[model samples]
Target: MTTLQVEGLTKVFGRGAGRTVAVQPMDLEIDTSTALGIVGESGSGKSTLARLLVGFETPTAGAIHLDGRPISRMLSMPRERREFRRAVQFVAQDTFSAFDPRRTLRDAVATPLRVLREVTGPAADAEIRDVLGLLQLDPALLDRYPSQVSGGQRQRFALARSLVVRPQILLCDEVVSALDVSVQGAVLNMIRDYCETYRVGLGFISHGLPATTFIADTLLVMRHGAVVETGPTEQVVDRPEHPYTRTLLDAYRRGPRRVVAVDPVA
Candidate 1:
């Protein structure tokens, strides 16, 4: 199983007057077959942490290691960079705009297989169709552009694209916040199943506690760009140590549980 370790990971935007700290220095590690749920309100830096872990945002300072090797030094080499990307993926919050409206869904999925895995032509088509089938998405949707489908469809398609690469670590940022409860359930199930079946590590970042806890076994609560509390999902949910975590849990209970949407434990 792949293990991703980060120490003193930090992200700061700008310098001097305009400086803003997106993610405070944090230490964490994740392994395949485990789900780490990141919960926080808007601007809490949960997304920033996901972006940093996936290399979408370079850390202002800190060190990252994948399977004991330094990520930065590995990324500098083309071979290792491609390998690193194939192993880690980030599913962003905005699934709609995450795609290019100009390209057909088939092209979008095929791009990764062609680039990262070096599969081409008929092989790419085969893999794309297979992943679509795995996600239970209709193959016909592959011919349509991103705008031609519903939000749920786009989200599934995006998921299929990521799964096509067979990533070892999947970092999802607020994937279910927009979809209705029904659609959310479907997407969440698909993600959990894939991760379980493939022994893939998951980083679920979201503001919604239920949605995040539904997929994550471990909880990481954040506020003001720093971690507030973290531990087993049940402990943090039932016996939150920090006041902020208790506030999150209290707010969550006051709302519609929708606990039936997606159950975490298989």
Candidate 2:
């Protein structure tokens, strides 16, 4: 099985008395067939962790390993960097901002193929169609601009773009937080199914406990850039060992639940 490992991963900003630790030294391992959920309140370093995984930000300390091989050194070479990009993909929370407002869906989703040189011409077209279909996005919508679609559709398109790269691991940073409750469920299900089918390791970061429970097999709860609890989702959710985790669960239970109508995609 393919595995991604993080060892002593840490990130900090500023220096001296003004310094702030965004992500404390953390260790995690994710198998290709498994999903890991990270839940935390705002400024808890959830997004910072995701950025570190995807190489968006330089880590003050730590290393990322793919299948037991260190990837940080390989990332320095041109060819290896392209391969790294293909192996790891990211989906951001701001779907609208992820896409270029001026580009059509086809252009946005196909950019990875072109950049990665994975496929071209008719092959790329076919792959794009297949990925969009898997995401339950209408192929007709491919001709439309990002601004023309609903927020849910935009998020689905963002996922489709990520899928085109055929990544071994996918990092989703609050991808469903902006959607309606019903839309959120659909997107979550879609992500679960896609990861299972492709055996893609998933790192899902979210503030919503219920949503994390619905999607992740393992849970990592964080507070102030540190892990408060880590265990199987069921154990962590049902019998939280940490007060912070229990408080999170309690907050979710007290929140109002809203039901929204969702469309069935063939």
Candidate 3:
């Protein structure tokens, strides 16, 4: 029953003539077991929104609440801030930059456990193995560095690093965009499985609507910095109200057999 809410969130960069509104005023909420999909072409504000939710980016004007408790107060308090960070996790698309080439994946995954959760020694080792097993990854892969694994493996490892934290809400930004069609499908299915199994709220961000269709319970479509459409996944995909949404559905219909391999990064 953990709920994360954001209201009137806005982000503006630069000033005057060079100013750019990365995100417009917006509101969104997600709780445990709710899968919310956010889709838009490249340059859309979905990524910015994700950053804002996770506190990686500060909002120009807005408020965030966790279970009706303002994030402002939670963040201001040291112990609450630490706890709040653990409740939300972000998995990024770029795996190449996430880990150190010299260290084993095991060490990388174990850092957060030791630092944030204060889990170490045998407890941390068991936790790492358990999370990896859930991802269907072998414990053997932990010995390998980031360079040694395939893109799909590296991506899953990135996710495992976050899942090791056992977050209540998980946000992924294009975690499957770089994989092959087959690999992408497996990763997407894995995403669905892990989130559901853990009862975690999911904020899935992607450029293609088709990618979100099978996984999202609620879909929010964005154009530029504005939300063009938002509703149950079936309604938005089937009876698209906006012209831009229709265009997305049309593109999906006309796409090739590997339909999920759509990255309209416009």
Q: Where does model 2 exceed 4 Å of error?
A: 256-262
Candidate 1: regions farther than 4 A off:
259-266
Alpha-carbon error at 263 in model 2, in Å?
3.9
Report the CA-based lDDT of candidate 3 relative to the real structure.
0.85
How do the residues 1-266 of candidate 2 rate in per-residue lDDT, one tens digit apiece? 77889999999999999999999999998778879999999999999999888788889998988777677765778887888788889999998678899899999999998897668899999999998877888899999999998988999999999999999899999998888887888888888889999899999999988788888999999999999899998898789999999899899878743222345442
Q: What is the C-alpha lDDT of each candidate?
A: 0.87, 0.88, 0.85
246 Cα displacement, candidate 2 (Å): 0.5
Which residue pairs clash in candidate 3?
A: none
Pairs that collide, model 2: none
- Model 2 quality (TM-score): 0.94
- Clashes within 3 Å, all models in order: 0, 0, 0
lDDT tens readout by residue for model 1, 1-266 = 89999999999999999999999999999899689999999999998898888777789999889999888877889999999999998788697678998999988988988899999988788888888876778889889999998888888888988899989999999888998787888788888888998899998899999888788999999999999999999889989889999898999999866534443211
RMSD, one per candidate, in order: 2.8, 2.0, 3.9
Question: Looking at candidate 1, what is the lDDT of residue 2?
Answer: 98
Instruction: Show the lowest summed lDDT stretch of 10 residues, model 3.
Output: 257-266
- Scored against the true structure, residue 219 in model 1 reaches a CA lDDT of 93
